[model samples]
Target: IANDNPYKYQRRLASITSATVAELDVAIPDPGLTTAVAVTVSDPIDVENGAMFSVFQAACDHEFAKLIRHKDLRRYHSWYQMKLREALMADQRDETIQNGYMQDSDEWGLPLGEVEY
Candidate 1:
């Protein structure tokens, strides 16, 4: 059920991801851990939240870089252009913050995907 709470989305998304990741066996070339060991060390790097958030950050970084390099909207002088610039800046800030969150979570042994490409 879709809860009307804004926070529910984040939590629901995490739960879905955990379910999916839980189903996937460790992607190791060889199996070594027994069920007990797996339960203790299993991580979510290959899961939904980590991968999803990583992708978001990567895309944001790419777009921000492109904007800074190209300055494609430089020629414009309109309300729309102003809004675009503001939105892009905000997105960059958000991406940075998300990155920090992911890093901290990963440090705590929550699998946040590899450093985004």
Candidate 2:
């Protein structure tokens, strides 16, 4: 089969081994409650971050399918949509640095600014 047919070349790759939960921080400004939780995956799926994201999308799709029966499902879909956007954006920003797609502050054209909580 020629490379032109991508399906013929499809292969299963091992899961990402170099990945680790960098940090987990939580804060509640109102009551001044703060905590740090650790997250880890012992056997993560063998797929790119984009594939993992697609899993999330599939879940959203499944929920949407159920929305046809229950009107309240629409509310869940709206909430999940916002959460999906936030997760995707955060993943994109982090992956840019994690995957070596971007260099340090000096390499980037834009100047770095302090991130506010």
Candidate 3:
């Protein structure tokens, strides 16, 4: 908390959130966050415009549980890891923008090519 970097608070928040997720064992159903798909696509999904995130959220919510076998948990973890890896990649490379700790909508995720840091 002594550092002066602008992203310090955001980093702290992320750390807390991650820790909470890691420790979570109860799955409280949230109806307001519920969404449904009108149709299923057999073809590949193109997430170039950040559409996959919504699906990810819904899937996680739908799959939430209070407990699981060790084997099942490991399998779930690996599955998520693989899918998340794909989510962050595009054009055969990482599409994640290291835009620092921007807290503002206009400032967050601003590609370095478009503006100076």
| Residue range 8-51, candidate 1, lDDT tens digits | 11111123345435333334333553233323222435524443
lDDT of 2 by residue, 1-117 (tens): 234334312223334354542322332234322224322333344545664566476556747657566655545555544444455456665554423223354544232221111
Local distance difference test, per candidate? 0.37, 0.43, 0.38
Measured by TM-score, how close is model 2 to the native structure?
Answer: 0.28
* Residue clash pairs of candidate 1: none
Which regions in candidate 3 have their CA more than 4 angstroms from the true location? 1-71, 91-117
Candidates in descending TM-score order: 2, 3, 1
Model 3, CA-based lDDT: 0.38
Number of the predicted model whose TM-score against the real structure is largest: 2
Error of 2 at 42 (Å): 13
Ranking by lDDT: 2, 3, 1
Candidate 3 C-alpha lDDT tens digits along 1-117: 233333211111112255223212333255442233122223234344553664475346435621433434544544544454445443345444343222334743443223231
Q: Give all TM-scores, in the order shown.
A: 0.20, 0.28, 0.27
lDDT pick, better of 1 and 2: 2
Q: Flag clash pairs in model 2.
A: none
RMSD of 1: 16.6
Worst 10 residues of 2 by lDDT: 108-117
